[model samples]
Target: MARTVEDAAGAPHILIVGGGYVGMYTALRLQKKLKRELRRGEVKVTVVDPNSYMTYQPFLPEAAAGNISPRHVVVPLRRVLPKCTVRKARVTELNHDEGWAIVQPLAGPPERIHYDYLVMAAGAVPRLLPIPGLAENGISLKTVGEAIHLRNHVLEQLEIAESTDDAELRRKALTFVFVGGGFAGVEAIAELEDMTRDATKYMRKVTPQDLRFMLVEATDRILPEVGPEMGRWTAEQFRGRGIDVKMKTLLVSAVDGRIELSDGSSFQAGTLVWNAGVKPSPVVRRGDLPVDGKGRVKGTEYLTIEGLVRAFTAGDNAAIPDLTQDGEFCPPNAQHAVRQAKLLGDNIVRSLRGKALKPYVHGNLGTVAGLGLHKGVANPLGIKLKGWPAWFFHRSYHGAMVPTLNRKIRVVADWTLALFLKRETVSLATVEQPRADFELAALDGAGHRNAERPVSENAA
Candidate 1:
């Protein structure tokens, strides 16, 4: 139902969509700055997202490898933004021209929401290709659910390898293949390989040497963000660990776990991780909002949607001008998104006060990625670091940036615990459908005083 709120409520509404990094940060800043407006009920902040939490994505690889607890990597929206109305829903339609958005609740039919202003920061999803069998076999590392599932899947493969009698079956069970060479792909494969190699120590039959790890990339190098030299070095690091770093190769097909590569090679692998790239969120094309050729909401350096009144966007979904470089847009990364959200929040507040909006300018803080526990690479402020120092810097920097003091403390605690204890490797794959045994029991009448009884003839 398209219902309108009466003005008797008094305060103007500001609806924020996509409660990720941008949405959460923007609303937090607004709540503090517009203290008067919020306290006096002069303005209302409502945020709509599919989840009730904002996930800190950088920790996903660690979470998948059992280095960090999955629970610690996500921030609860309701707890973090008490002043903001956090609604769990998916935005199906947004027509800012009429100041209304149609959103479907998590479990219900679509409903319409009218807002005075809009913030589109829904973020991006993994860009997928039409490679055969990828739909059935490929796993992604985007969300916590996917991370947990990957952890279980990897562990289960180890168990399979340990129990299998056939040599080819064991080989297939131990083969792990990853597609893509970007930050996500490299870090994920590295961390996961590290964990699995360690897991082999506990298995009776499986050894580190038995596992085959391969990274398939279409490009000549990996981690282009760190430059070709560093990318080559990173590839060498993986190769040294017995990982097949397949450069200039693409996953042609994976029909029924038969991974066919563009390099005229094929393999039977149990795992396929896709981390090729990300396009902007599909939300951008929903309305008349201007967008670049890439489908990202066209945003000025000021972080406002071009010529859209009271409309602002930031994060991966927005193609905000890259004032730091010529003829380039800001690359969609956590470093940029976190910085832009602060500026976007301030600009939104400034707009409310009818003040001039300032253009966003960010100095590249450089990139840092952890390969495993005590190994990584970092380029912070032009100083290149590798090994343990780089790994420490990577964890320290991300810990400081994971949003909210509570999450920061929790993540730090998770790391602290990892130092004392071995990696957690409990695979709860059956938990996905936990009651199957009970359902089977019911079907077979396994425990039945009533099941043995005949139905009454008088029963309807």
Candidate 2:
């Protein structure tokens, strides 16, 4: 147990964990609604997260494809929630029974904080499986950093294939495999394949045909959220574009860059992207709070944790009941997360003021997915759209929902410029190891000095 900070008397303190969709939005609403309470010191709000920014995950594929700047996809938490106290730390332990949590800061020892209200929105992490070489070689597409790195890595592989004379090496460098057929996997592969094909126009030796993109899905269809007909259409579109959509197939092993599939196929790939799925953050189960069999904290339609009126949870980590559909729960997606957060914020304010709380009962509005520039699918209000119109709708909806006006302008500007300008395909892989060049130079300088020195001096 860490030393608990002395709780200030009179005012009730609200402590929120994680700065992603739910936490950020909840804080934003609370700060705006409780301005008078906060100013008068009648109530307090503090947000604790490992990162200071909230990533708009819907734009991650675009960011990875270089359609949008990586910086524009993330909103700074402190800048957005100026009225609330933003603590840059991760909650390592939670003891709801004692009304305290142990938080570990990036640079300091752990400390405990006490609060009257709690909000759990730690979000989810990439669901990795126990397959050979996956832990060593596979890469994920969950964060802004990962997306940028993937872009650099893909471009670098293309350069390698273009310069290499060895046919096997070239083949390996040109082959890209993606496991899973969910929205993340589908969008990532589509955007990257489109970008790579467009980039080949500038290469002297590499052509779009040389690139082999494979999507391995255990399930029979992709993008189940878009319904069966749309999923079939998506697969057909991918196949027509020269992408190998291997349905009802599984990746058996990927040992040392060599991929073996359940269908008795083996191949070498330079890039292996894993977007299988995501699991709830483990911290949600650290306390005695009730959780379902899937490890998600149980939540009521009111957005409050079950059996705990003062505690709230939303987003990927909470299994909140879906009131619109009997015996069902809300799906873990940005649309639901954002809406639940707004309602939760209002409910919390109402609860604080001794008012009756309302239940969250919003039906599924729609679903949209972008398949690279001007290609998309959407089912809004039961009206199915395809191609350019769907793509336009996808951009419009997300652009409108991307937090602040500053980011909205930046994202729109990036899209607007991309329409007229030629695609930029330069690889900056060195950004992953910024100090590598300086370190190599230092080693070379040391070698040169050693060579110039006398034999005895060198020996010494």
**Per-residue lDDT of 1-460 in model 1, one digit per residue for the tens?**
6444443264678888899889998898888888888887788899999999999999999999999889999999999888888989888788999988888887766778888878999999989899999989999998999999999999999999999889999999999999999999999999999999889888899999999999999988999998887788889999999999999999999999999999889879999999999988887788778988888998988898999889999999998888879878889998888788888888888888899999989898889989998999888998888889999999999998889888889889989988888887767889778876545444433444345433342121
lDDT, candidate 1, residue 38? 81
C-alpha TM-score for every candidate: 0.95, 0.96
Put down candidate 2 lDDT per residue, 165-279, tens digits, no spaces. 9999999999999998999999999999999999899999899999999999999999999999999999999999999999899888899999999999999999999999999
Pick the lDDT winner: 2
Give the residue spans of candidate 2 off by over 4 A: 1-3, 444-460
What is the alpha-carbon lDDT for the whole of candidate 1? 0.88
